[model samples]
Target: MTGSIDRFDEVVDEAWGRAFRGRPLADRVFYLASELGDFSVLWLIIAAAQGLRSDADADESIRLSLLLLAESILVNQGIKRLVRRPRPAATEPRPHHVRQPGTSSFPSGHASSALAAAGIMSHRHPRAAPLYYGLAAVVATSRIHVKVHHASDVVVGAAIGIGFARLAARVWPPPGER
Candidate 1:
């Protein structure tokens, strides 16, 4: 079973690598998105921007930031340690420079953090849910496009992130919900 899954992952990863690894526009977009997702910088920037709107927005932003921190620690430090999966090797020369994270690639920290942030932000800014999820999708998929994670890794990481956000919402609630 595990072998089959690994084979599937390899096939998909190779396909994605062939499709987008060398394209100029795709390289630029995915690379930028991947960079923005590093350490959840893009999400943090969004949270900071949201804070500038009003006191209520600021409160939500704080909650989102805190959740992101916890999510990062849990995913990057705790879960990645348990999984200990190595990142995908570059089969072909990369067209653009991309950061190679040292952590396990079973569950992408970038994807996990991105989805978690998106889920939380969506609750507070329901109208902007599309934007939140769209950014999350990009950040999550960028891991595969940049050849740092398997497709399964990103998918599972995204699931973990969504689950974490749901659990957080129940425990902490959003600003208005409480």
Candidate 2:
């Protein structure tokens, strides 16, 4: 089982290298995305913007921001500490500057937060669901493009994010819904 997992990581690393590592344009875009995703900065910005519309929007924005904070703490502090997985080694010099996260690489915190934000935001604005999820995809995948996380790590993180958002909805619901 360990051998197979190692092989899978190698294959994914090779594929990611071919797809995104050296290309200047992809590197720039993904590096920016990854940086923006740090500490869920992009999502917080969106939430603040959403808050400007009305009182209800402001309330939802506050809730989303709080949820994002909780999600980050849970994933980064709680889960990463338990997993204790090391990130991929720096095999070659990176084409762009990327922050080295000091956390376990088994489940990506950026991916988790992005998906959780997307899910919660989408519930409030169903018409903008595509935009929400599309940004989530970019933020999540950028972790891979920048070689900060394994594909499986992002996948599992996204799953956890989706689950967290669903549970949040059940417990709190949206502003209008019961």
Candidate 3:
């Protein structure tokens, strides 16, 4: 089982190297996109600022941000310890490939937070759903492009993010007025 998992990780890493890594322009874009989930704080700040415009909007943003922050912690600090999977090591990362998290890689925290934020925010503001989802998708994929996580890592992270967001939304309903 361990051998199979190692093989899978290796194959995915190889594919990522061929397709995404070493590409100058794309590497930079993906590196920046991944920062959207950095500490899950950027999204939180955006939510907090947006919340200032209207109470309902603000409420949803703050709620979603907080939920995402909690989810990020759960994935990064909690689950990652159990998984203990190291990140895909890039032999020679570009200048933009800056993040080097000293944590497990099975569940990309960035991916999780991005998806969670998207799910929660999209639920509150349906019209901006596409944008929220798109950003999450980019952040999730960027984890792989930057060699910080395997494809499966980001995939599972996204699932966790979406699931947690749904759970949070159901348990703690956001303000509704538009």
Best by lDDT: 2
Ranked by lDDT, the better of candidates 1 and 2 is 2
Model 1 poorest 10 in a row by lDDT: 88-97
* Candidate 1: regions farther than 4 A off: none
Better of 1 and 3 by TM-score: 1
TM-score of each: 0.95, 0.96, 0.88
Rank order (by lDDT, best first): 2, 1, 3
lDDT of 2 by residue, 12-76 (tens): 88998897788999889899999999999999999999999999999999999999999998999
Runs of candidate 2 with Cα error greater than 4 angstroms are none
**Tens-digit lDDT track of model 1 for 99-148:** 88888988988889989998998887789999999999999999989889
lDDT for model 2, please: 0.91
